[model samples]
Target chain A: METAFTPFTSFGGGLAIGLGAVLLMLGLGRIFGATGIMSGAVFITSRAELSWRLALIAGMVLAPVTLFFVTGQMPVLNVPVSPTMIVIGGVIVGLGASLGSGCTSGHGVCGLSRLSVRSLVAVPTFMVTAAITVFIIRHVFGA
Target chain B: MKLFYALITGLVFGIGISLSGMMDPAKVLNFFDLAGTWDPSLAFVMGGALIVTFVGYRLVWRRDAPLFEARFRIPTGTAIDRNLVGGSALFGIGWGIAGFCPGAAIPALGTGRWEVALFLLAVTAGFYLRRLLAPMQTARAAS
Candidate 1:
């Protein structure tokens, strides 16, 4: 499939992201952490908050799906890993996001912007672990 | 009311990222294809983020306190020691290996992209490692 991904398009995307992140922080006094959002949807039993959580997630899932329909341009990615590896990987990330108390957006973007020491620590660790894992998978294990 | 605002704003943010092309992993992957063709998309995204953040931080600082909170919780410690350097190095390595950082990876998963799942798993594992070692690191510091 032909793709027209360009830097100009990304600038528009970045603007939205920056604005949204700032609004969330100022409006709700909460951080934008995807792992935390997922965890909240699953673990939070309060009915009052459930719909909002689900909506936030639905928005995330739906936005791209909708875009794919409108533009006929869903991102094309090639994955060489088996389903078992996928599950293992998801579990690892879920745990890491939880332990870190934020994902990349929370720490890397929002937290880093705030100069949070904890984020400074967590973001780098996340980056290094990802690199080493990728190396091992592609080179040594050939996964 | 607060929750309502959060949901609406969050959805808008998610969609903005998608439409702007920041959430599309394939576009990001091109940047990692440094040997074949230099993709400048990453720079745009970073530039956009920095621009927004530069202004947003200043605005936030002048407020005397966060809009929804009693105070802005800046990190107290001023020292740039081991934790700072080590974590940052690790994060850069992870980003180098997996083109997807934490925030982007979460959205990518919605597209049924399994590589993101793998990346997430590593992120989760990293989180746990930090948690498990936190106590020991603190103890070692005391001794």
Candidate 2:
């Protein structure tokens, strides 16, 4: 399948994420880690922690409603993989992100932004492995 | 007030992912498929966000404390041990297989897909199971 090269839109989107992450740091002195936010939303018992996480999740879920108002259409998403593959992948991601203590937003964006040595190691290792996995699936197995 | 900031932050992030088209698993997968259909949009997204986040973080850190919080609650761990590398490798494999990072999936929940819901549920299960196994891994590390 041919992919669209969306330089402008992607860059614009990056700016928005940067702004969002910066806002979190400036206002709450927190790193905007999505997985952490998600898991905490489910597991953390602190009243304050839960409140903010729920609020953030609500915003995320409601964002498309806002998009509908402005763009007159909701953003469409495509899941190319089968449901079983999606479930298996999701389970693996959970184990991995939990063990690693972060995911893309955490390590890739927040940690790398801070220039943390640990994250510096993390970013490349994951990238190469991701590339290799794709190679295996696409070229080797020919999926 | 803190909750409000978090809500806005999430909204911004949701908007970013939507506009960047990261919510579309096929688009993300195409980025990994270098030989078949290479999309450089993801690179631009990362590069653009990095520029802003790198500079923005520097500025944010100049303050003694955040606007609402007394101190930053960032991670303190610096270890680059087995868990770090191994966990990241697993996460990368999962990402390559499905093209859905937690960062993208959380926001995509707005799209109301059954696949997203099921994947998220599986992830939650994986997280708890990993947490349960944490002590064993730590004991192994110590021994």
Candidate 3:
């Protein structure tokens, strides 16, 4: 369960993510909120909206393929939780994000960058809860 | 043009996520587990992203509008209401239960794992459920 600090790689990745957000704002005048984008894709409220959402999602799905070409293999990610837990957690996240109108990418990243007061409040609220949840799951339930 | 630009933007974001180790649910979970073998790497991802996006969005905002869009679609709401707080709190619980945020989980779908697929499906159902319950909330507000 021990993990080494990954400052260098994490920073490098963060920079790339920042650049991507910059591109969206600069080019499309839009925020790069993952949940919002995906929901918009799911609902497909407008034809104009569909193009950008689908395009963005396609690009997201293609990332591993891009990495495969670069590294000659797929990147395997660890879920670290039970399948039922993943589904339950995922549903809660989905519902919560919709109700809150943003998630980490939306409120934590892009929203904070813009200095939105709502995001400033939101980022901490979620961080605390997530930490508490982890505490309960790991220590109390010992999952 | 908007679609193309969005696609490329998504590409960069997805690649950044893959590179940053955000895809690893354990890595993310450890960040929350302060009493355990905590990994502080995820902070850098948010920090690195904020540095660029903070400056980048500002620079972009100086422009009259984005290249592809006629206007910025920035969120107008600023109130720190119950919905914002409560929804985010719920999301935090879900995130703690599973380290996979929507941003991380969506791209990991490329792994073609049934777990990821099911998790996402559950998330979609949650969103649909929320939409179904929205009228109740609206009616309450109207009353």
RMSD of 2: 1.3
Misplaced by over 4 Å in model 1 are A1-5, A30-59, A66-108, A111-143, B20-26, B60-71, B74-77
Q: Write the per-residue lDDT of candidate 3 for residues B65-84, one digit (tens) a residue.
A: 89998988888789999879
Q: Score the docking of each candidate (DockQ).
A: 0.31, 0.77, 0.81
For candidate 1, write residues B47-129 as lDDT tens digits.
Answer: 67657755776676676665655666443554555655555455544454445555666556668765666666666666656
Whichever of 2 and 3 has more DockQ, that candidate is 3
Ranking by lDDT: 3, 2, 1
Candidate by candidate, in order, the iRMS in Å equals 4.5, 1.1, 1.1
Task: List lDDT for all candidates, in order.
Answer: 0.59, 0.83, 0.87
- Chain A of candidate 2 gets a TM-score of 0.94
lDDT of 2 at A65: 73
- Ranked by TM-score, top first: 3, 2, 1
Error of 1 at B24 (Å): 4.4
**Candidate closest to the true structure, highest lDDT:** 3
Q: Candidate 2 chain A, which ten residues in sequence have the lowest lDDT sum? A: A59-68
Candidate 1 lDDT tens digits, A9-97? 67876776777677655654455666666666656779754765676665565555666877887744544345555545544555445
- Candidate 3: global Cα-lDDT? 0.87
